[model samples]
Target chain A: MRHRARRKVNQFILHCILLLGGALMVAPFVWMVLSSFKPSLEVISINFSFFPRRWTLANYIRVFREVSLGRAYINSLLVASCVTLSVLFSATAAGYLFSKLRFRGRDQLFILTLASVMIPPHIVLVPLYTLMNRLQWINTYQGLMFPFLMSAFGIFLMRQFIRGIPNDLVEAARIDGASDFRIYWSVILPLVRSALAVLGILTFLWNYDEFLWPLVVVHDNRMMTIPLILGHFTQAEAKFPGESMAACTLVVVPVLVVYAFFQTQFVKGISMTGLKG
Target chain B: MVAKRRVFNTYIILVASIVFIYYVLVCVWPFAFNLYLSFRKTDLLTEDKFIGLGNFRFLWKDPIFWRSLRNNIFYLAMMVPLGIVTSLFAAALIYRTSGIMRKVYTALYFAPVVTSMAAASLIWQLLYYPKIGLFARILSSLFRLDPNSLTFLQNPTTALLCIIIMDVWKDSGLRTVIFLAGMDEIPDSIFESARIEGASEWRQFFSLTVPLLRPQLIFVGAIYSINAIRLFVPVYMMTGNPPGGPANSTKVLAIQMYQEAFYGLRFGYGATISMVIFALLVGLVILELRSFEQRWEY
Candidate 1:
């Protein structure tokens, strides 16, 4: 009975500590959402209040009115979706070929592909911009979407997941006169659905939050993605903290929604990436 | 059968070729061009001239370049270890718990990781607002500091540190989840035996948990360091009027590279800075791989 009480005390202490940490972790976001609803004068006022005295939709309304946020949302959605789909198809195909097919120089090719992961995007920024310029793709969706169509990490991830699939399944399909392409589409792709989903989520989030490339390539306001638009909003109109918070909330809402619905998959995906290292 | 095999090989080749072409155009070609441009005197507008190491020489003496490098190193030193320690603590606490509580805590922590850096920076900027900010109000009232005098982002001495704090806050959730996953992989029997042998929780944690969690630690450490070295968004978003202001105190290598290339129109010089970043990251990655390889052999 004494030992049970001691354990309970310990657990209580742990909970206290964790809850404090959790509050610290969550405070900024709560503050963001709350501040978004606060009137503009109150947002930047010296006297900090946790909750707004008077709530208003003025900030959000201003966000929509002053900026091309609606267009930017559509732009972000289009780019993220296209990039995700392209990555899935290319990664799955390449993953299938690397894991199941035999060919000359295949190992070398796979190593080359894997090594590209080390080449950070900044290294290629200048030349890629120049290339985009030369190709007349600057300020175009193609420029924003082209370079990230497939990623080395995606290919490697798909390959790792695909290799786990039983060889007999592919063999059985082959024996049934299903061509390699058909086997890939009909057999391999479905079996690695979880990995595909993981890759899809990761790819979409990455493309959606991408800032530097779009900042450089797409100078036109209409072509701006969410991150770029938010960046501009913060940089240009930082005086209006309420509206900036509203814009920030708008930018974060979609990702938070996805995260809420797919928390397990999200955690699993992170673990898989971490464990791969 | 021979014809069928040939057709299959062709299909594979075709698919592989498409990926290869994309990689080459996007990755290889750009990289090769970056390397070439790093040695040339051209802004993509003028006729190209061979400047052979001129850009490097300029960067060698540039005070801002040195300052940016120092800031990046400072950020890495502060962020990497602090991030790992805080996340490890959070993970250790959460790892002992289960059920809905675990889910709630994990999600709460991870909320920031999913938020875009732009949004995270904006939110943090408001939090660090001088007199009106929540933190300023709390700090001043609790510690009896003057709230009206406090300026977090505008003050050069505290600006980078403020950014680092926000970064650690933003990133620790993901690190915590990763650490929790690592902790979960440790077999329960090991802990049971440690307890049977009369080891305290602290003793078990240090002796068993720490050593076993080395790979995850290394991973989190390396990734955090890499991210810190490439720090851009927060500094870009949160800093003063010109960004990286209060006298260029918050300027990092990645930001400097961007400014020099795009805004300054010094493509060759920017490429040179990028190569420096590239070299540093590759060195870190290689070291990480080597350590991991050694562990695998053991």
Candidate 2:
């Protein structure tokens, strides 16, 4: 009875600590969304409240009118979708070759590609930006999508996932006179649908949040993605706390809503990023 | 038949080479070009003039470059161990628990990582709004000091620390999840045996669990160090009005590189700064890849 009581106390302590940390982890996001809905004055009022004293869409309306928030949103959607599709294609095709096909210097080529993940865009942005300038691609959709067209992590994840499919399936398809392209299209693609989903979701989230590249290449407001447009809040932070909150909410809520629907896959994809070989 | 197979094999190889060709264009070529640009003088509008080590010599004396480099080092120093160890501890605790509770805790922790970092930083900026913000309100009452005087982000001494703390919040979830997955790979039987030996829970963890988690810890360290060195969005978003301001306290390698290259139009000088990051990252990536390959053997 004494041991059981001690165990119960320890468990309770653990619960208290984890729950406290969990609240801290979740509070800012909740605060942002709630505070955005609050009347502009209430957000920065001396008496702080978690919920809106009187909810309003004034902040959102103000932001959309002053800043090109809607255009930025559409730009984000376009760039993210295009980049995600391109990354998926690049990753899946490379993954198929790395896992399923044999070619000269294949392993070395893969290691080279994988190394690209470590090479942050900042390092390459100058030269690439200059090149884009020469090509007259700056502030264009092509410019925004160019640097992000390939993802090394996507390739690596797809390779790891694709490696698990039984070789007999590929060979059997070959015996049935299904061409290599057909095997990849039918057999490998179907088998790796879950991996593709994970990569797609992850790719979309990452590309949408990408700030530095967009900030550099996009000199015009019309070309701005969500992050580049968030630069608006910085202009007069002290004057408009509610506007900043609303912009943040606009940037964050959709991603969270999507994550809510695909929480398990997002978790698996995120956790696997480090742990997967 | 063999000739036909050769043709088919070429088609497959051609398909795979698409990424390779694009990789060369986007990644490889620019890396080489950046290196070359580091040694030359041009903003791409002017005629490219070769100037050997001119950029580096200037960067060597540039106090801001040193400051940027120092800040990047400080970021690596503070963020890495705090992120890794705390996440490891958090993961270990979560691992001990069971069922729906585990999923809920993880999802909540990971919520920030999925949310837009730009947005997250903005939210944090509000929370640091000296007078009416949460930090000021709490710290004021607890310490019996004026909340108006806090000025956390504006105060140069505290700015970098604030960003690093917020980063720890944003990122610890990722590290924790990674560590959680690593812990899952560790067999319960191993702990069971340790328990049978009358080992304390702490002893079992310190002895068996920690040592086994060495690769994950190192991998997370190297990976995040590369990330922290290239820190931009958080610093930019958090520090308002001429970012890296209030004495340029929060300026990091990537921010410096951006300002120099894009705004200042000192293309060669900017490339030199960025090349520093590239070299540092390559070393970290090598370290990460070493552990990464070792993970397969494990």
Candidate 3:
């Protein structure tokens, strides 16, 4: 009876601790969301309450009205979608080729791609900007989308994944006289759908959060992405605290939603990708 | 049959060509240009003149460049171990728990990893507000310290430290999740045998768990080290761009490169700093890969 009582107490303590940690982890996001709805005065008030006494959608309204917040959203979505699609297609094709095709210097070429991961983007930022300038692609869609079209990491990941698919399956497709493209499109893509899912999420996430390149390339406010806009907002006075919070909240929500929807894949992707690197 | 063969070769060539060109354009060409630029002497308005190893010599003499390099190393030194150990502990704690609670705690820890650094840093900048900030409030309540007396980010003593702490807070979940996955791979039989031999929890953890998790430790360490070197956002957003307050204590190599390139428009000088960063990263990568090979055998 005493042991049972002790066990019950231990369980309660564990639950309390874990729950508290969960609350702590989630508090900032909750705060960001909640504070976005509060009036500007209430946001910075020392006696600020957790829940707003007067909930208003005015901050969101103001963000949309004053800042190019809506335009930034569309810009992020368009740029990220294009980049993600391009990355998916090129990476999948290249990964398939590297994995299956009989090629000259395949291993050496792969190592060359692997080496690209080490060259920090900052190393090439100036030259890339120069290149873009020369091409007259600055502030253009192609300019914004050009550098991100093929990810070495994505190609490497797809190679690892395609290597796991049984060779006999590809052989079977070939026997049916299915061409390489057909096999990749119909047979291989379906089989490696999980890898595609992970890659898609990562590509979207990175492009969505990309700041410096966009900040540099994009001159017009209409072309600015959410992170770039947020930087602009920060540079502006900190007086519009509510609008700032709302804008931050807007920049964050899509990632949160995607992450929530695909938490398992997201976790798996991060861990597996880390191991690969 | 002839048509099919023709089609296959065409497809293969098409893909190969596209991949090769894209690789060269995006990855290879940029580095090549960076290499070229780094060797030249050029300002914004002048034509770049080839000056072999002169830019590197200039970098060698630059005090600010060296200071930034030193600061980055200091930041990495503080961040890497704290990130690794705290995450490992957090993962262990979560792994020890059972049922749905595990998922709940794991999700909470991972929340920060998914959020944008811009948003998080912005929120934290508010939290770091000197007098009315959460840090000040907590310190004042617990230790009888004055809330208004603290100057956190503006002070050299605490600015870098604050950045490191914020980084750990924002990213430890990723490390924890990684460690948890590593720990999950340890077969139950090993722990069962340890228990049968009357091993204490400490013994089991130290002897069985730590040894088993060597590969993961190396992986997490290497990854976090690379990430620490690229620590841009927290320093940039939280400390502000120039890192130019009381002292430029928080200026890192990436930020320096950025300023040199974009702000100063000395593309050649910026490329030089970038090459320096690349060399430092390469040095770290060599160390990491060696550790990888050693741990790989186990």
DockQ-based ranking, best first?
A: 2, 1, 3
Which candidate, 1 or 2, would have the higher lDDT against the true structure? Answer: 1
Q: TM-score for all predictions?
A: 0.97, 0.94, 0.94
Q: For model 2, which pairs clash?
A: none
lDDT of 1 by residue, B1-298 (tens): 1123453476677987897787788878888889998998777887578899999999999999999999999999999989988998899999978899899899989989888988898888878888757788889889999887788888889889999999999988889988898899889999998899999999998888888889998888889888887888889888855678778889999999998988888888899999999888889889888878775321
Model 1 achieves a DockQ score of 0.62
> Which candidate has the highest TM-score of all?
1
Q: Count the backbone clashes (under 3 Å) in each candidate.
A: 0, 0, 0
Clashing pairs in 3: none
TM-score, prediction 2: 0.94
* Candidate 2 per-residue lDDT over residues B1-298, each given as its tens digit: 1113353485556866776787787788889989999999887776679999988899989999888889889988999988887898899899888899998889888888888888888888888887667788889889998887898998888989989889999988888888888888998899898899899999988998888887778778877887788889999998876678779899888888888877888888888888999888878777776766764333
Q: Name the best candidate (by DockQ).
A: 2
Residues A81-196, candidate 1, lDDT per residue (tens digit)? Answer: 99999999999999888888877777878887877777756667998888898999999999999878888888988888888888888888888898888988899888988888
Query: Ranking by lDDT, best first?
Result: 1, 2, 3
Candidate 3, residues A153-265, lDDT tens digits: the string is 89989988888888888888888989888988998889888888878888988888887788778999888888878876554425777787888898887778877777778
Task: Write down the C-alpha DockQ for each prediction.
Answer: 0.62, 0.62, 0.51
Give lDDT: candidate 3, residue B47. 72
For model 1, the interface Cα RMSD in angstroms equals 2.7
Task: Considering the two chains of model 3, state its CAPRI-style docking category.
Answer: medium
